[model samples]
Target: MISYEEVQKHVSADDCWVIIKGRVYDVTNFIALHPGGRQAILSHAGKEVTELFSMLHPSDALENLPPEACLGLVDPNTVPAQENVLTESDLQRRAAREIMPPAQSMMLLRDFEEWAQRVLSETAWAYYRSASDEEHTFMENQDAFRRYFFRPRVLVRDMSTGSTETTFMGIETSMPVFISPAAMAKLGHPLGEVNLTRAAGDWDIVQAISSNASCSVDEIFEASSEDQPLIFQLYLNKDRSQSETLIRKVEKLGARAIMFTVDTSWDSKRTLDSRAKAPTSADASSATVATLPVNRAISGYQDRNLTWDDIAFIRKNTKLPIIVKGIQSLEDVEMCVSHGVEGVVISNHGGRQADYAPAPIDILYEIRALRPELFEKTEIMIDGGIRCGADVVKAIALGAKAVGLGRPFLYANGTHGEEGVRRVMEILHEEITNTMRNIGANTIEQLKPEMVGPAGPWVGANRPPYIKQ
Candidate 1:
């Protein structure tokens, strides 16, 4: 058994050793291959990293390392007791949590975001809230939804039996809204994506598991019921064999579909996240200001050469339905249909990848106007800037099969864990039903394009003439 003193001697980047859950590992060789960057591991070299490791990775993540890396267990007696010193941010977060409103008081989806901003750490808040560059697309995403107005058919019929139930890629769901895949959920809460899984299973809604999730596929699946449908969102690895292994693993684990994210060929400039100090550093001002942003650090291994031809590679590996996510333009949507893609999520990566990318709602409008037939050719879904149940109703009216949400759920889960997520779902379900009832639609099929129209005369312009003045 290695002593704690022995571990401390090998702390340099050239020779790194760390203790994870009492087991010692010499991770010198694996540092270069680490997807989250070498600095992420080097920061805590020669230290016990159980707490930090558990936050960002599953228990079995170290299994991927070579056998030689396992230098056996460290002597428990030799290890010193860890100090429980809290930072100023930690004190502020704790203080905020004490005075925060109860979960039931959060009636709206945006309400959760307001609380999350107050409770989350600077790094976590920045990571979830930041958008690319000037965040033009980010702000525009929500603004675009305001461009349309619902035309309610009053006194048509007494509608108390309206249902939000719908099928996504042939799987039945409680509502048209599904939780969109987001990375590193543990940053928000300790249980992370597992909180989402259990909540989704309980509520009978779909949950798309992220490739960069803090929980393992086995853990997320185990948290779900046997028949609960789950989708796997993939970021293709540069090493083809690694992705192949992952595809086979998820298929065996009962993932019903694969959402291949295709927009992020390279990382974008998220100024907020970049400006926030890295959590791994003790002295953020000196140690981490110049380090890579969280997005780039975790996404380094994602294949930058990803193309349309790579779709075939995924098709050959699994029988699961392929849904191309991050389709931004009509031409790309047509290409997806031609390729026989089972579905497509019209998204701009939640406005986190491209600075000025068009909002998903606007793209949905373009598709409806130009190639309406494509709606029937493949399942059309949308995400980005969706905040309320009315937004869900509007998207359905414009031909979206279902809607997906990322940041709202992230904020909800961040603030209140599983209960926060369930509350958001509950609020959305109520909102969708209310909107449907008011609009004289009793079923998902009744929502039509005619029910919605462009808002006023200044529909597509950046701002109204009066605002410019």
Candidate 2:
């Protein structure tokens, strides 16, 4: 039996897969008959293979060669070979009994060292969780979670249906949960973003595609259902044209909304990212995250140097409603309303940016006041530190139309890939249903701020350098 540790640990240079640039390469354990023409295992032997090419020479070199057979890893680009198409048997093997992995939840949520050790390859988890400047807000985000002391409510009925189902923007979805556009999924699974799309569709939920997604917009869309509501998250880049081009592609593909991510301006400083080394593959694309542009200016100018005016420009380019993420100020909220940008997703970019920024919930009241014209037209959402059903209920009661889940779903992706996400979704669903029944609230609208209050510290409090919305 392959332990989860063994699976992740064993994926080394020797334990490799055949891949091709700009083409699909499927290694579904159909080792008996590879569509790539060569004996399956023979295909992905060495790195930097090239020029004079034949499978046998390399295969024999690996098989019958002397004791020190490893002649160093070959560079993939140098390998001048044609890509092999995946056959039905390849699909069958791919569908065949896959190696089961261990539990998804890392010890990190509870233990810092264990979490760090678990997600060694996927560094973003560690980087995003770190603290910034004085780390006041960092401490506050965690402390906020503790404040919500889980008060067990006695129910009158035994048949309580906990619903993770909720809506985002104007569309109804299975749960408030959506795939949080995590970039470079292939880093975790061979199928990459392709695998994630399957989970989203099967579960009947929305997908908030990452600005720096590993798979191309076209590729991910091809893998997902035609009717699956897609929201394209944008990182305002230094190169405005590239962002504009990407946004247009999403609009053409029928994305329901544009989630303008004001959060990620630079590559987040993560301890794991700096440490983990990746084994290269052809089919494995980097999601072009580092090169892509994501910029944000606070002035609301949208100039040759982008400002909030760019929000209106984004709206003009596409028909989708724009939800401004990375908002912590009431001033930004009022401006979004004034600019006709549609909605606001109160977030601190999940603490990936400034470590000590305000928690989305901490500043919820100030921003909710902006949408006082009443709920229907202008919507409110938040992401960060949400772990349970009560967390979902608390956000709703505090005027969040819904919430966006990031880390938990990533945990889902890492633990069981598609199945893990489905499991986490079901757990959250039951938790939500449980929260509703316990609170005696039938509809989502019944949740009020008073029904929920800080079980912990709401950071970045006091006054700001701002105007009241």
RMSD of each: 4.0, 13.3
Q: Model 2: runs farther than 4 Å from truth?
A: 1-139, 148-164, 266-268, 275-304, 366-377, 456-469
lDDT of 1 by residue, 44-63 (tens): 89999998788778767888
Off by over 4 Å in 1: 75-83, 278-291, 457-469
Winning candidate number (TM-score): 1
* Model 2 weakest lDDT span, ten residues long: 291-300
How far does residue 413 in candidate 2 sit from its true spot (Å)?
1.2
Candidate 1: C-alpha RMSD after superposition: 4.0
Put down candidate 2 lDDT per residue, 149-259, tens digits, no spaces.
333344534434434466768888876656665554544444556566777788887888876565567777888886988788886655578678878888999888998
